[model samples]
Target: MAKTKKNVNEMSFLDHLEELRWHLIRAVIAVFIAAIAAFIAKGFIFDTLIFGPTKPTFFTYDILCSISQSLGLDDSFCFNEAAFEIQSRTMAGQFSAHMWTAITAGFIIAFPYVLYELWKFISPGLHPNERKHSRGFIIISSILFFLGVLFGYYVICPLSINFLGTYQVSDKVHNDFDLSSYISLIRSSVLACGLIFELPIIIYFLAKVGVITPEFLRKYRKFALIIVLVVSAIITPPDIASQVIVAIPVLILYEVSIFIARFVTKRQNSKALKNV
Candidate 1:
């Protein structure tokens, strides 16, 4: 490790850029390799996972249906099937969607290794203490990302597909969605939620750098709630219940981020006092 550190320290700016280029190349290679696997497993990727939400017997639909039935509410969640047709208009549309979907899946599956490569590139510049403090960064970030992806896939995607699929302006209008549109919805939801779930990590780093404090987070709590609600509304069905369900977790994350900020600030202050 010391020898590796010495090599890093001796590297010129151009050499550093070259090293970064190699890391990026390796990351891209990892993604492409995973994409090949996904492409080979077309049935599982397309039928089992991507199109699961459009089916009536999807897990989220069944659970929500039971809840609605128990509560004697409207049977919005008890639909038979999503009232939409996905078609490829252009000649290469289906092929293009397939390749892109596999690539996106590849990136999602290979995210941890990509993060590792990125961490490797940056860790050489960090102090040993800083590196030690962030030992669990990759693992924790990966877990959060996977959780967010699951939530988006199981909850948000289903809700959006259900609502938008059945929506109709008139009897004359049909909901024939483009194949790319459907894939885009799933991809965006999963990726967006994955990144959003890294809130605590982002806050911790910002606090460590003295950019934000817990007090700032507490002061802006109300604004954060409003923003969460808006985001929830955007991602979920028009129903208040769905919006509340989505907002609850995000609000909890915000509170957790505040706590993380507080912890980082306290640690930094203690270290400063020790140095004095």
Candidate 2:
């Protein structure tokens, strides 16, 4: 027989902690299984995916080159050859990179499961209506995260690699990047963008909790724009085109977040009035 779930109201603090521990354990196990798979696919993970952006024939490069040609702009984004070499300086550097990369991939692959575990932990505390309303939270969050990861991999990663890899302050300085450094850049970009794309979800929860209001978001619209531009500059290549491309999506997400926040606020007000 399956184990019955304990009622949240009847559970003590220790019981809550124990419940959380089990959820975390399950989530970790899922990640470990996924990571093992990633580790086993070393050739595909390393050669095809990790180092793909460094190659001139990368898909992003081809698309960007075509766009540039069609626009009659200089082929600044297109390159004939890779401009940098990656090397492992430490004796165990390759092994370490492979291990950590696998773990990162595992976490990403198992993100939906992790979210499910998280939702299971918290759902007991929410009202039945709230739980029903948020039935698609895991799916929506997973979709947003995957979209962000793709945007990072296909757009931000290639632009940064093309610019930074090809940049030459002096001919004397050769761009021989370390393996760890290269992997770190790709990992950070992919993960950072993935989290950043959860803006609307974050706003919805904040509004639900009365922590933030839609008017507050609108009042700080100018500040948010400046912050978005700054973040775009930080993430993308230091070029206007790259920055604009990044900023536009983020701006759109922000607007969507505002709409979500407003909807949440209106619903909360309606609930309050009904209760009265």
Candidate 3:
């Protein structure tokens, strides 16, 4: 379906802004309420989810150990606990970390509702046909986002924490990591993957609008692989193994996005032919 011109829309600028305000308000309320719920479940969040990666018995570590054993490498990478300690370097550091962590957790948990609000705002500009086609937007995007978050938390963050937390140039150089640093690692892992997982949605929109195409994605597939590996290397441990582990899933997602783009274009062609 054709999109309405933004400037020619019935709503005036002020009216559009007002409409946007309501969407933002609803989104904020959703996040805030979810955060409060997460805050009340402090034990589960702080110990079970947040700190689980630091323990050797964590599922990620166990999987890594098994992989290492198969490769004839010492499973030293699978540790019972990270050798580093998290400390608060400032008076308000611990409290600040807690508050922000809760907020981020809230945002993560409230992601679906947030997407719903966004879709509500954008849907008004779409044709009725387009709106109908987008019926599953919220569910599909939310599932992809949560899957990415789990991967980051369970796979990427744990590997990173296990590796960085243990790396030492000298015995004297202790790994007394600040609370803020630890939280940053976790936050980055969660948020980065959350955003990255939206690639399919992005490609969908781009393909829908004719900006990106299946052929374009296919033409530069090798280049995309390099970029994905580089991105994985940036966000993960230095080891090739870790980088490959992270890159593989992202590459697969990219391939899936290309297929989605192709399918969309094919459907559009079929529809156009039917109309003619």
Candidate 4:
């Protein structure tokens, strides 16, 4: 079956801007609506999810404890609680953090809708076959994003909290962490991982457009590892184990991206042969 290309509506630059403006407006509305819901559910957002890693009874801690026991290691993982105390020093610190956190959560939750709006703006220019092949773009991207978020929240964030919350240079100096700083760590970690996991999707598109190839990805594999390690080091605590833990998934995603590029190139080659 031959795929038909849709006739793209030609428009002036201002008209294109108008179309883009509408898409942006709709995306913003989606985020706003989701943010309102997040604001309404304050207890769940703050107490349950946000503060989960700070408690000793977090699921990750228990799993670590079990692993340590099974490995005949010391009870280092069997800590009673996180050492740091979170505080809002400024008068508007708590309120500001609450509002921004709600907005960030909204963006995270409405990610798929946001992607859909972006796709709508771009899809008209794509061939019908391209549009058809990319029908699952929003869903696949959303799943990868959420998985990355979970990995950050469960693995990376916990490791960071455990290490930083416990480390002490002196007994006299208390770990009185600012509320904003604490939330920022969580936000950056989750969002960074979410973006990182989109590497395969990014590579797929780049390959499709002939901007990058499987060979390029392969040639730069070692360099990519170095960059990933550097990124992992920046987001995670200054520990080899923490950096390695965060880098592992990212490295896996890179390998998957190489395969995606190869698949896209192979398909493009086959299509070219058919056309010839």
Candidate 5:
């Protein structure tokens, strides 16, 4: 006869670890498969997406230029051409960048699958009601992540590239960025924003576990604002406009997280009252 699977409560610690290992293995395999697909689409991934912000005709530039012109502002937002040149200084630089970029793209493409794997591992330990309440976790998180990625690519990346690429202290100095450096900027912006946009989901879990409450978030709203600004400054170019643009959505997310925490707390309280 086949061995029966043990319930989560009956499983030994090592068995739990083994279960986790399998989930992680499956997630990694999914990522690798996605990465392979990304590797095969090098032209679209690099020329059309990764290097898109560096072009003068990028969507972000054209929009910003149009807005600036309509508002009667200076031509600072308009770009005739990108001033900096990207070069591979080392023999393996281009190859290494290509490989890493593919991996990053793979992780992004397979994000929902990864979350599904993670949910499968954790759901077994949760009550049926808890699991039911969180049925939309993977979908909601994936949507937020993709939205953040789009925002970073269309707003932050172009702003940073335009500013840094054209800025020169003196006419004698020219900006010649390395291939890895340029890719790194794009990768970091996309991934960081994606993760940052998961703030509401993270807050929901913390509230469910009683680690935080809406009151706590409300109390620290000022500090959160400061932290958001600081984080915006770190991720974006050192300019007020870029920082403000990045900070707006994050601040909105923080407020939404507070509302979520409040809802979770109210549900928990009502459930407790019903059991009394």
Candidate 6:
């Protein structure tokens, strides 16, 4: 039997649109199911997950304190309190917040299935060899995403919460944080880091398509470092120590992506030569 290769580029406009519609429909269904589950788990979602990092007794704080003691460093990780209280300013605010929170939670939980669906839609258009080589797309992308989310939650969220929550202008005023503001920090940190962690995957495909070169990455590495630090600073605390910590992992990922692209391009060239 002939391989059923569908050349999507050769399809008519309506056909292309129809194919895209199915991919989107599947992704939406996955998200909806995950959201409904999250909505029903109000206890675990709100108290355990959302408020976990903000507390002094959170696991991240405890682990950091242990490390600090081992290193003979002052208890930099110790926080007596966040010094802020969250509240709703209007009617329906709490209800609106709950609905939106569940939706965001749904998207996060459904991320892996969402990526799998997207890969399925795009893979049919790839050459057979390309598809075979990228067979681990769903697994690899999902791992990267989870790593990013963990980094955001354990590193970024804690730092931001500690800094902003503790900062005070005057003794006359108290910190009464809005519910929306609290949720936005968690949402942005998790989502932003999740996307940023896909640098390797993005660079891999770009290189496969001849859009990026390892040599180019090496040539502009110093510039890339500057950009990474700037991004880290924008998202993290203004302190040099916090910025450095965030930038280090990202820089490592960028360097790793360069190596991946080099290996991929070399493999592609070798295959071409063998064919010739």
For all predicted structures, in order, the TM-scores are 0.95, 0.96, 0.94, 0.94, 0.96, 0.93
Writing each residue's lDDT as its tens digit, candidate 4 over 4-88 gives 2223475656666777788899999999999999998999999998999998889898987788789787765555777889999
lDDT of each: 0.91, 0.92, 0.88, 0.88, 0.91, 0.87
- Inter-residue clash pairs, candidate 4: none
Badly placed stretches (over 4 Å) of model 1 are 1-9
lDDT sort, best first:
2, 5, 1, 4, 3, 6
Badly placed stretches (over 4 Å) of model 2 are 1-4
Each candidate's number of clashing pairs is: 0, 0, 0, 0, 0, 0
Report the lDDT tens digits of candidate 2 across residue range 33-128: 999999999999999999999888898999999898998888878967887899999999999999999999999999999999999999989999
Q: Number of clashes in model 2?
A: 0
In the range 68-120, model 6's lDDT, one tens digit per residue, is 68878776566667799999898988888888999998998999999988887
The total number of steric clashes, by the backbone 3 Å criterion, in model 6 comes to 0
Tens digits of per-residue lDDT for model 3 on 174-250? 99998899989999998899889889999999999989999999999999999998899899888888898999889
In angstroms, how far off is 28's CA in candidate 4?
A: 0.5
Among these predictions, the greatest lDDT belongs to 2
True-structure lDDT of candidate 1: 0.91
lDDT measured at residue 256 in model 3 versus the true structure, 0 to 100: 95
lDDT of model 5 at position 46? 95
